[model samples]
Target: MTDEEPPAARRGPTWLIVVVVAAALAVCCCSGVIGLTVAGSAGLLGR
Candidate 1:
């Protein structure tokens, strides 16, 4: 039997995937905070 290296297609870059996921999380968190702020100001939070 011969041992050969895998193709590049099967070993894609992971940094790109990590960056995309991090950016998505940041956007979601920021939007949630902004929404709460707006709701509080409008007296929609029952405060």
Candidate 2:
């Protein structure tokens, strides 16, 4: 109800936060892999 309250108490749910963070991390990892693959191919192609 107030700033003095712990963040968890004021927030809705821990599992929801966990799920969102996990999904974000998965996206970042997948994107990073795709980027690396593209870069590697580009290097081979000298582009």
Candidate 3:
């Protein structure tokens, strides 16, 4: 039997996982920025 594996099976779902992780990070960063902006604005108004 040949030891070499097919390319498709060797690289299964790696791209999909990277995309999902990037999307999650993007969402988290956006929310964090928005939350910080709101908090800063509130602080300024209170001062």
TM-score (all chains, Cα) for each model: 0.73, 0.64, 0.67
Task: Compare the candidates by TM-score and give the number of the best one.
Answer: 1
* Model 3: lDDT of residue 26: 100
User: Which one wins by TM-score: 1 or 2?
Assistant: 1
lDDT for 30 in candidate 2 is 100
Our tally of clashes for model 1 stands at 0
lDDT of 1 by residue, 1-47 (tens): 13344444444656668888999999999999999999999999999
Q: CA shift at 47, candidate 3, in angstroms?
A: 7.2
* lDDT of candidate 2 at residue 19, scale 0 to 100: 86
lDDT of 2 by residue, 1-47 (tens): 67657786646678788889999999999999998889888895465
How well does model 1 score by local distance difference test? 0.83
Regions of model 1 farther than 4 Å from truth:
1-12
Clashes of each: 0, 0, 0
lDDT of 3 by residue, 1-47 (tens): 35556666566678788989999999999999998889888895465
Clashes of 3: 0
Candidate order, lDDT descending: 2, 1, 3
Off by over 4 Å in 2: 1-12, 44-47
On the 0 to 100 scale, the lDDT of residue 34 in model 1 is 100
